[model samples]
Target: MNETKAATASTPGTHAHTGMTTRHDTWWLAPLLVATGFTLFIVYATFRAFENNYYEIGSIISPFYSPKIDLPGWPFSPAILILWMPAGFRATCYYYRKAYYRAYFLTPPACGVSVWGSKSYTGERAFPFVLQNLHRYFFYLAVLVLTILWYDVFKSMLEPSFHFDLVTLIMTVNCVLLSGYTFGCHAYRHLAGGGLNCFSTNESTKQRFKVWEFVTKLNEHHMAWAWFSLFSVGFTDFYIRQVCAGVFPNPVFF
Candidate 1:
């Protein structure tokens, strides 16, 4: 028994003494993929936001420019006004925080892998990390933004003449994916019923529990929805931009 205890205690320290690392294969690949995908998205989004034009065509508005607020004498992109809220929301997303921290910061790039930061790690309690507490507030603002996006989707369907075009279909699908991403938010699930002490104590609480369960299921695949929505929104903007630029005519089906 004494030998077993001594061996167990010494095993963990052996890695540090010998400079040994994780045993997992391909540990670096996931973070590399995440970094590549996120970097491309940031570059593309920055370019589109600055371009400003081709954001609207007929009734189809780019997701980047939905609920467009024209600020008189404002020098920067109009997309700034609408984009900031969602941008903040996504930046503070729980899943995204884990992703960027791993991919960009190399904070234990993968499970079983060695962490790459300083020995002193103060997570989510210092300087910038403390700001993540604002995610819930961002969630509220995102709900409003999502409402406007859905309105855009409906408006796209109600063009003067009844016709379905590639842009229209893309915008509609974008809304759906965005909805999945937004509604599946961990903050939203908590808001639904996470604070309740007992679900059976009250009818209202029980009802909220049901809603919470549904949101929980959605939250399980939040990562998938997050990536899908990101690509879908960017593609929606690109499609609208291309069509508006006359690079390609919108194929319509009535």
Candidate 2:
């Protein structure tokens, strides 16, 4: 009877005024900015992804529409063939999940801030969120796509014959930033050596520990990498698309 009564009793939340936090400053700024930036990118990327034109120029192809797959009867954009890999990888990214969760969902937008109508949480064991476990598999696919991106960049050399252009530099920088963000992932860090309690086990373990150390350094700035790469990739596609659209010529130099 006591247990039932206790369970049925309603209790108020933490003490303090101003909605679970006494903070009077502009605490909502970060999430608001994040939401705005991500929303803009979503709109831009969606338009670019679906429009299916100007995504390629000479040897440069937008990251969104890579590999250039063509099926005999498929009547949709070729991006649907490969874009899902990178999309899935980013969607399941640990840093991105936290980012969108706070910015978009506003499930307690910030530390000590509370959202109305929220219930007790049992972690990501719930539906939809549990799908995040696929991050590791997506990490493997990300690596594969990264390799292909490198191949595309190399093609820039052969097509234009050992010359460099603004697009090449942009593509290279974007690839580097994407690589940093990807290698810094928590899932990738775990693969470097998560379960191992001891790094002194043997030479192999020592090697993995070194890799883990590198990934840890990258993970420390994972958020920064995420943002930079996001901008870089988006700009890369935009610049290439503009060049393809005859808005401007891609300045080339040998």
Q: What is the C-alpha lDDT of each candidate?
A: 0.83, 0.82
Report the Cα lDDT for residue 51, model 2. Answer: 91
Question: What ranges in model 2 sit over 4 Å off?
Answer: 1-20
Candidate 1 lDDT by residue in tens digits, 56-157: 878878888889888999998889888999999999999999999889976656554545533556778998899999999999999999999888877877
Candidate No. with top lDDT: 1
TM-scores for every predicted model: 0.90, 0.90
lDDT tens digits by residue: candidate 2, 143-197: 9988888888889867868878888888899999999999999999999988998
Tell me how many clashing residue pairs each candidate has: 0, 0
Candidate 1 backbone collisions, by pair:
none
Show model 1 residue runs off by greater than 4 Å: 1-20
List all candidate RMSDs to the true structure: 4.2, 5.4
Model 1 Cα RMSD, 1 decimal: 4.2
